[model samples]
Target: MESSAAKYCCDNINNHGSSSQSQTSTCMQKFRLYETRSNFYMIGRDKSRTYWRVLKIDRLDPSELNIREDSTTYTESECSELLRRIHEGNISTGGLRFVTICYGIVGFIKFLGPYYMLLITKRRQIGSIRGHNVYAVSKTEMIPVPNATVNSSIADSKDENRYKKLLCTVDLTKDFFFSYSYHVMLSLQKNLCNNEPGQFLYETMFVWNEFLTRGIRGHLQNTLWTVALVYGFFKQATLSVSGRDFKLTLIARRSRHYAGTR
Candidate 1:
């Protein structure tokens, strides 16, 4: 627990606080833009340029921004028309902390209060001793995709404020944890605990149970695979056997749930 806490603290310090305006400017150090007949792609880099991000832009009606209604769906033609108008107009966010496009489709969850969007704010690379690099989720930001409208009446009860407070009270760095690299257990008790349906199981589906998918989640969406290290555990050495050089080989079957770490 101490190590986890320390690491979290150090990561925040390393990021110099997620809210710093300067970080947003460097969020995408250098970027490349690509487009297909069906989609538009934006590949971004951090200030270091060692890091990379790929996002997709969606063209939807303003009304569709509200995640509450299920009826708000866009057909392929409409989506393309929207994309067509965007690039044709050369409209861009320019340099804002916000990205007009989306990164990838990890998934989203439905809740009672509001539609919450989990976005990766910053990612930290853990080490690549095994000739491969692994990254951990260094930071994230939560944006609420609001519905039509909440009761903004002057006579509205205090419960509205309380509800907002409840959501705002969450300290994502401490309360919610994520790592693109490894399955960091939540707690010892949780590790020993059997999961129920629709819970935080590693390979569960409902976490991202949403129809509105966009971004780097292409025909081959395998970004999550980057976090796992397959067989770095086995050490290799050469030896002389009968005056002949010999190499050792070990085969391992990775776990389906959490395959990378071994």
Candidate 2:
């Protein structure tokens, strides 16, 4: 009997026209049919009626069911039109995509902001101390004794000593200058750090520092110190992942230290 009543309700719904009123009428008819068939079974009658009510509510046009608008003011056509507009992208463009891009850029800059300030502070501090050899005593202490004699047969070791001297004496200012690359790289790294993104920082820093101490010394020459500074900056930035490829090119231009040497 329950199956027959349910089938009867479904048939009426299908046969009726698609108008909202027709849908409502079909629902009412189904409810009445179920009640009559299950008159003796109160529980079954109650369950069927409740099910029919839910089906009726579900059949109603969703557009006409605005919670924000007053129930008394809602109309089927108006609700349908609203839903259509939303589907067609007639709403504002201020969505998560735009907001996310904006926030990501801002957050990236914010993360690198302090490092930039520190760079400026360092530059100014060095500038203020210019012409004063603060490490003069240390330099004097490390210098080889002028009168010390070594075995002439060990001439091969002289090349190694020369290389070390070059590494220590290369003037960094001649080859490099302060720029935004480091800041950007640091920012990128910080952004990655927040999300725990990559291992580039550790790996690249080790390689870059080794390159600076040895590989870059011969070509850097008078600008050796500048190259070291720039290389350090690049290493930091690359570690952060904010460093771009083009800036590395700019830094490479001053790498004359690698010129005549292998």
Candidate 3:
């Protein structure tokens, strides 16, 4: 894809004919440092860092560059404001104009392609909710009831009240389970994609998933007795850090317990 700067330049070149020279020069000045060697040692006054040694920069294709150094500078406030505007649902090009200008200016001094520059430029604007507001539900009005005023008619309707309460609790529990389960699945999928399968983090995730799934299933069934059962299983699974074998065993146990209950 053409870099955002390149696209911007193409669009503005005709409208600002005389101004294209400075803009193009600025674009050319940004050079991305494409380093091939991944391993490098940095020695500092108090600390040193080691990176894995890999390919040589000389072996890399001339067109491939990794790091870009741009001279564009913006105050944190300005960046925050741009992000705020974005968060407030203004996603149009005009809404992003300030951010684009900020990056384009910076790109002149830095060595980055327009694409990468745009990516970095918009990093601050991705997840901010600066101009958003949240309103909470208001409390319901309370009706005064005398402590001694128990009508026989209402008392006779206790079974209906109990049934209604049970139905509401069950619905609430189901809603909670669905929401929590979706998040758990998302988290597990993210971890699996980002990390090695046999790693400690991965194994722990398996254990967590097993424990959580059992608990959620138990809750869905309204098996009140299984609450402590799942909790204890999760506590044990998390506390034991021997390795994958132990974690697998815990997961198996949780699965078996869930199956038996069903």
TM-score of each: 0.33, 0.20, 0.16
Show where candidate 1 strays beyond 4 Å.
Answer: 1-85, 90-107, 146-170, 174-201, 204-262
- By summed lDDT, the worst window of 10 consecutive residues in model 3 runs over 39-48
The lowest-lDDT stretch of 10 consecutive residues in candidate 2 is 99-108
The deviation in Å at residue 129 for candidate 2 is: 23
Candidate 2 lDDT for residue 188: 38
Rank the models by lDDT, top first: 1, 2, 3
lDDT tens per residue, model 2, 174-252: 3233321122223334634543211232123322222323311222111111111233222212222456342122112
Flag regions of model 2 displaced more than 4 Å: 1-157, 173-200, 205-207, 210-262
Please write out the lDDT profile of model 3 over residues 1-262, one tens digit for every residue: 2234433422322232122122212111111121112200100110011111111011112222222111222244543442343323323322222211111011111111111111111111111112221111111111111111222344326664564345335221111111101112124346346532211221232232233224222222221111111111211122346553332211112232343442
lDDT of each candidate versus the true structure:
0.33, 0.22, 0.21
- What is the overall TM-score of model 3 with all chains considered together? 0.16
Going through the candidates in the order shown, the clash numbers are: 3, 14, 12
